[model samples]
Target: MSNLPQSLSLNVPFGAGPSGVVPGGAGSAPAANKDRKMASAEQLVLDLSNTELRENALLELSKKRELFQDLAPLLWNSFGTIAALLQEIVSIYPMLSPPTLNPAQSNRVCNALALLQCVASHPETRMLFLKAHIPLYLYPFLNTGSKTRPFEYLRLTSLGVIGALVKVDDTEVISFLLSTEIIPLCLRTMEMGSELSKTVATFIVQKILLDELGLDYICTTAERFFAVGRVLAHMVAVLAEQPSPRLLKHIIRCYLRLADNPRACEALRHCLPDMLRDGTFSACLREDPTTRRWLQQLLSIVGGNRVSPLQSGGGFEHMMVN
Candidate 1:
């Protein structure tokens, strides 16, 4: 997923061709040429319905997704566009089992996912995107265990779609996700994905934890809290070896959010990794003042300096209290 917020500027030029037009450069085009470009992009959207034209159209739109600031409604309102995108996803299911997904095929499905991410990001289309159960279609990609480039790209892009949904403030997005296996899926990524993919997955979890309902859900059971806490603790240890300020920032935010719940906060007092409360990450977080502040606040709230029975380098799982 791109580091930019998923909710930021997803408009597509509905009728424009895939000229990859930049906003500043559009004013320089002749009026007649602009009309043609609009017609071409519209044709490209329409061509999504054509099996022969779909691949090229998907490529053009996906390549220039950032420029499609106004096209989400058009994509959603247009007939068969969403279906076409899902078709692109489902077609690749066969290859996933055998782990035969080459870069070319992965790129094609990822392109389709990019379009879906746009739809997932737009307010007008977001609820509709969820109502269609579209996010579930991408979970298979997230569940795959392959470390190949193609599979990694697929996982990262799929996380982008979920990340886009959670970027919205609505409880409905969290509600939908909490009802699914998204938490475990994200935890799996946090454990095994590349640094970038792990960052996106952790971002998704951070957004979820920021939601009130999501916080309650995670803390509702000792099992759930420990499930999330253990993975986060493990990631902190891994990053301590080879730091990623970006991923570490999200992980810290998640821990801080978990601290907002009384029970979870109490559990964290015993189970929160020393690396987070200690000065271990100070160098890695030198430029990130906000994360540094969050770390301090989390430590203060969880009574960070106190030693626990589990502090003898024991696993976080053993620190959980009933």
Candidate 2:
């Protein structure tokens, strides 16, 4: 049950304690009273053994963006508790081990990650997750190879958090992501992860390549540009073997994003011909109009047609034939 006063407005300060003022900030009597109430409510939820109860309590609290934004220091201190609970559910143990999600623990882990994701959605609050190294805790849930019920769902949810962070347009978050191994992990998942995992990975990869904040990071240097190119090429190369229709579609969309950047386009310019010619991509082009349209656009950019639907809204959709 929430201890928040019925009259205390949700319109609290950007970083108020729980739902009030911070411990040190202008510690007025009323604000201190509110902070103590908030801390108690949080402690109550944290004490509950039922992960769902914790999720519901946190869920209700997280609805107030100010809780994360204003009380970041106080809120960030909770990340360790979150990480511990997360470890219990996924059994990844400090994130250095392979995940082995027990069926019983699956739902709880998803709920906790959902809570973490809610915090990550706030641009200012997202730094808390990164500073707490939450990604390290989150990524291993995706390791379960099973595509059936829970594991696949967990993978999708984990990827969803990363994708959401990308959209937040924060430089610190983007910088942290670029520094981590997450990019390679997403690339691998995009190529061969479970069907839904592939979809989430594709979104994250596309967001990274196309998100404006990411452009500076992705295009900072020749080697960085080339690294992006190499990763894109490798995704295409993976298509050569298994060549799932769905996977091919995701990769094609990612290329459409790639085509938007002049730097990425130039780095991938030569690879386009081989990719377009690849038996898998070519076959998909013949059968799927969406794939056909996107590939044509990518080819046109690399080939100097520079047709940009985002810019000119032109006949960029026109299909190209061999």
Question: In order, what is each prediction's RMSD in angstroms?
Answer: 7.4, 9.9
Tell me the tens digit of each residue's lDDT in model 2 across 34-86: 66656554553344334556655544544543443333333444424455445
Per-residue CA lDDT of candidate 1, range 1-322, in tens?
A: 2242212224544443467353435566665565555455566787788899899999998887666445687688776678889999999999999899999999999999999999999888999999989999999999999999999999999999999999878898899999999999999999999999999999998998999999989888778888898899999999999999999999999999998887677677777898887799999999999999999899988876755645533323344432
Q: Report lDDT (CA) for all predictions.
A: 0.84, 0.60
Clashes of 1: 13
Best by lDDT: 1
| Candidate 2: regions farther than 4 A off | 1-84, 87-100, 143-149, 211-250, 260-267, 273-295, 304-322
RMSD of 2: 9.9
Candidate no. 1 TM-score? 0.86
What TM-score does structure 2 among the candidates reach? 0.58
Clashes of each: 13, 3
Q: Against the true structure, candidate 2 has what lDDT?
A: 0.60
